[model samples]
Structures are given as C-alpha cells and as structure tokens.
Target: MEEEKISELKDKLEREKALLEEELSTVGERDIQNPDDWVAAPAEMDTSESDPSEQADAYEAYGENVGILHNLEIRYKNVRSALTRMEEGTYGVCSVCGELIEKERLEANPAADTCVAHKDEEV
Candidate 1:
C-alpha cells in the first residue's frame, strides 16, 4: 500500500480503537492481570434489598452485558492487532495467504488482517 493510504488507514484504525474502548467501558472493565482481556460489568442494581423480580432483572441485565462485552472485546482486540501490524510494517498483508490484502477490503474495514480471498480464514 502507498504510504499515504496506509497513513489514512492508520488514522481510521486509531479512531476505531478509541471508539471500541469507550464502548467496552460502558459494559465491561479490563482485567487487572490481563489488560487485553475485558470482563462484563456486573449490573449496578442492588437486588439484595429488593424483591425476587428485581434480582431476576439484575441477572438478565448481567447476561446481556456479557454478550455485548464479548463482541466488543473481539472487535477491540482486532483493532489493536491491526495497529500492531501497521507498526510492524505488515498492515496490508493477508495473514492466511501472505499476499497483499485488497485495498477495498482495507478501506471497508481498516482493521482487516486478511485479503478478501482469505477473510473467512481469519480468526
């Protein structure tokens, strides 16, 4: 990729990283021992003094947060990995095939680590 294009994508990735962190914070917190890991935040409601229905609601809310946090964590990690790849001079290469990733694919997902042909192969 051209230096200019790479720079543009770098900017996009950085912005996305910040956004992901913000979203992650809304429903989770980073693990103290593993900064890269995020755990879902427990629901804030105090159900101990409340009725059974309130306790159930708290549990349901926690479950929803877990699901949301899981998805956000994946995207956050991918964005971080993409930024690392950029620093290592391998930003636009497909991880699966070692080929230059499609420019459109990069534009569509600046955090992409695989070319179109190998996108499904990426974890």
Candidate 2:
C-alpha cells in the first residue's frame, strides 16, 4: 500500500477503534484483572419491584447485554490487532498465505488479516 493510502486506512481504523470502545463502554466494563478483557455490565434490578415477572425481565435484559458485549469485544480485539500490524508494517499481508490482501477486501474490512482465498480459514 502506498504511504498515502496507508495513512488513510490508519485514520479509519483509529476512528473505528474509538467508536468500538465507546459502544463497548455503554454495555460493558474493562476487567480490572485483565486489561484486554471486557465484561458485560450487570443490569440493575429495582428492589422496589417485588414482582417475579419484573425480575425475570431484568435478567433477560442482562442476557441480551452480555451477547452484545461479547460481539463488540471480538471486533475491538480485531481492530486492535490490525493497528498493531500496521505499526509492524505487515497490515496488508495475509497471515495464512503470506500474500497481499485484496484491496477491496481491506476496503470492506480494514481489520482483515487474510486474503479472500483464505478468509474462511481459521487463524
């Protein structure tokens, strides 16, 4: 990639990283024991609501937040890894095949670490 294109992608990745962190903060918190891990924020239950149905609803919402947090955490880690690769001067190389990742693929997903041919392969 040209220096100009790399700079543009770096800016995009940084923007995405910030957005992911913001979204993650809303539903989760960084684990104190593991700085890289994010745990879903537990839903606050209203003690005034003694109804069993209300309690169930609160638990359900917590479950949904857990799911959302899990997904956001995955994307956040991928974006961080891509940024590290960029710093290492290997951002555009496929990890599996050691080939240049397709420009269109990179455009579609700036965090991609593999070419289209090996995109489905486990890293």
Per lDDT, the best of the predicted structures is 1
Task: Compose the digit string of candidate 2's lDDT tens values, residues 1-123.
Answer: 998888888999999999998998999898999978899988889998799998999899899999999999889998999999999998999999999999999889999999999999834
Q: What is the per-residue lDDT of model 1 for residues 1-116, given as tens digits with 9 covering 90 to 100? A: 89999999999999998999999999999999999889999998874587888888989999999999999988999999999998999889999989999999999999899999
Candidate 1: misplaced stretches above 4 Å?
none
Top candidate (TM-score): 1
TM-score of each: 0.95, 0.94
Task: Give the TM-score comparing model 2 with the true structure, all chains together.
Answer: 0.94
Backbone clashes in candidate 2 total 0
Q: Number of clashes in every candidate structure?
A: 0, 0
For residue 9, model 2's alpha carbon misses the true position, in angstroms, by 0.7
